[model samples]
Target: MNVRHLIPTAAVAGAVVLGLTALSACSTSDAADRRPGDKLNVVASFYPMQFLAEEIGGTHVSVSTLTKPGVEPHDLELSPRQIGGLGDADYILYLKGIQPAVDDAIKLSESTHSVDAAKLTTLEDHGTETGGDEHGHEHEGEGAGADPHIWLDPVKYAEVAKGVGASLEKTDPGHAADYRKNTDALVKKLDTLNTAYKTGLRNTATKTFITTHSAFGYLAERYGLVQEGIAGIDPEAEPSPARIQEIHTIAEKSKATTVFFETLASDKTAKTVATDTGLRTDVLDPLEGITDKSKGDNYFEVMQSNLAALQKALGAK
Candidate 1:
């Protein structure tokens, strides 16, 4: 199935924000009334969550994403309509702590069944050298406590898929067998993807890679590679002068071929690092969202492209 990436205009964004305010004061009885549809109504937090919902739920589900394409997920603020209309959907699948506003809104929402994917995997602290202070903690958000880029690791993503499938089964027991079958198929594909990454990155000349942010920790960990980020887990956070200097030093020491930036975030830091270290720059997407700027349409294609970039940068045989 071809998934068309949605981009909301400024007017729509305003409406959503306004809807949130309206929801606080108004009744949502009008919104809660379900329309006739056999497909389960699923609202995903972002691209990765949306992918899992669609893949696991298949034609039995009608999936939508809260975060639009090309927008950074961390900066998302729920519209009043989105907040007020939570009960209109059957389930809301999200990665907890990644979006604080979403977390706050979800807590207030009593209507939708919220499924957090973060619980499906173990989290690790990939805190920056400058992450101990108050400013650092705020900048890191969910990332300060633990890295939330679990979806980058195929095995962990498959685990999340399993959990989501279980939720779907519980919610729609009549389709339990279908959900199980679809989940198994999705897991098989993810396993193949895992093998592809392992084989492609195997015995690279260098194990150390540089990225704009520390979002690739899980991916690097999966493939036995070392990740050096210009910024912390939060892409919006600025690296201090000391941290920048340290990154440059590490780049020189590791002989990193390319400094990588993500599609959704600024490439300024990565470009600056590249300029300082005399290295090239390229994209290594975290699969947060899909935009026209993305090299591929969906998760699998983009991940394969990422694998190729890693192989080139690491000088894989």
Candidate 2:
């Protein structure tokens, strides 16, 4: 993807206002890499992007996330302070179309280096429902756009990780070799993860799983399974009566045993499906962010937990 350095009008206005307000906050020693010993200030939009930067930039970069733990990234609205902070980032790492506010902030800020992870690989539409199911509701502004949960597929994530490492190399050329080495290590780990998922989900009795949202399209597709979601791409979108009926029909036909909900999203819809049918309910986290309810601290651990949940729910022998 091309680097975006153009600031929109709104971003320009916000920056001017913030610049005036914070004129006395600190001296001109306000560059992203000001202090000689300071790490590269890498501003990431949310958890996945932050994790990638930390993994590749490891020790060489200081990564900060805009969305705090336990928060939903899609609904994030940046404060003026956060917007100003973007200006101080040596590099901005984000997936375009996942968070609109962050996209606008990147456009508005004059940050020297910015990476859009979405550009690293192809994004499939993976329409919310299939096989004669009714059209489910999507987020208002996100109609029919490509799914943003590419990180769920380890292969795709590894590709994005490589792109991030390349960006870091460009931004910090002195440590280019380190970035490349770290990128290779991260890709190897992701390849191992891909192998685990393939082996674990290969012999499942059924190839279908139900969920509160369509966040697992890439994962399911990668592992030869199908995802039946109550809602469309957006988890916050309420499932209509027709949509619920569709999912019920799918679950019964596929003999799906569980309705999976994610950590950051409410389980009410999944539970409702479980209640209507005789299926159980379980957590199939999307790993949008780290939360108190998350089974592990980082992306890899949570993904492994998710694999275990899928294996049980899919009745793998």
Candidate 3:
């Protein structure tokens, strides 16, 4: 599933330009301790990341999300207030390439010395494939690289959670021990969730599913399931008629019982495909937003809900 050709050159260019400007305006300072009446101000790209930060940081940190709830992350553009919030925060957490707008805000925050440029543990641009059923699509450029939905997979997310805990400890050494404790608890929860997914998805009757976009690569690979997406890496991509037809054929052949759509993105394509095939369409959230139907206002709950969805969709009794 190489998707390099699908990486929008214009988006990358815009991100680069914004990053440079933001970085240039930022000022760096020696990391300092939290003063009396100070709380660690943290900013995240979207709901999932923010939820993680809030869960781990607890009473010590105040976390905010740059992208509003229910908005497609790829289409997000920071408002003046959001940009200002980034500069005022003590730390900003985001997955690169997943949200270019947040990346730009991080760069800008660097210049203003409002927030420390946190070290990112996950290298997003790697070309490693989270192997499942390859859909034989030739992506030309960086889009063909690895999928950025690492948080959807519990194993990868545990690693990310650990990294975040480490970063939080570094930012506020006074709370290092507490951060480690929180990390351990969060990791345990994630481990339980991982076991649930493996137990639920293994031996399911249907191993292949259809999605509105290529956001479930990590989940599908982790659970030995395959995904056929109508769109590419960019959620906004409009599938060609032929591509849509091809997905229909693949879904029919794979015995796909459900067509999954994301809350933050359009469901028109998924609905059309489901209608044509007479299969049900359901929401398989990417954890990009906090929707009313989401299990709760957090990542772990959302992942749990997704596993339940998979179980029902695959007919895993």
For model 2, how does the per-residue alpha-carbon lDDT over 1-317 read when each residue is reduced to its tens digit? 00123335476567546753564364322334456666888889999999999999998888899989987787676767777776566788999877776787777664557789999987877653221122343422234547778999999999999888888888888788999999999999999999999999999888889877667878888888877766655555567777667677878888789988888877777777788877899999888899889999999999999999999999998
* Candidate achieving higher TM-score, 2 or 3: 2
How well does candidate 2 score on lDDT at residue 100?
A: 71
Error of 1 at 205 (Å): 0.9
Residue 259 lDDT in model 3? 85
In candidate 3, what are the lDDT values of residues 79-128, reduced to their tens digit? 55566555456777777656655665566455333222223334342233
Which scores higher on lDDT, 2 or 3? 2
Output the worst ten-in-a-row residue range by lDDT, candidate 1.
Answer: 129-138
The models' CA-based lDDT, in order, is: 0.76, 0.78, 0.69
Q: State the TM-score for model 1.
A: 0.84
- Top-down TM-score ranking: 2, 1, 3
Best by TM-score: 2
Which predicted model would earn the best lDDT? Answer: 2
* Local accuracy of candidate 1 as per-residue lDDT tens digits, 122-159: 77664532122212332322234576778889999999
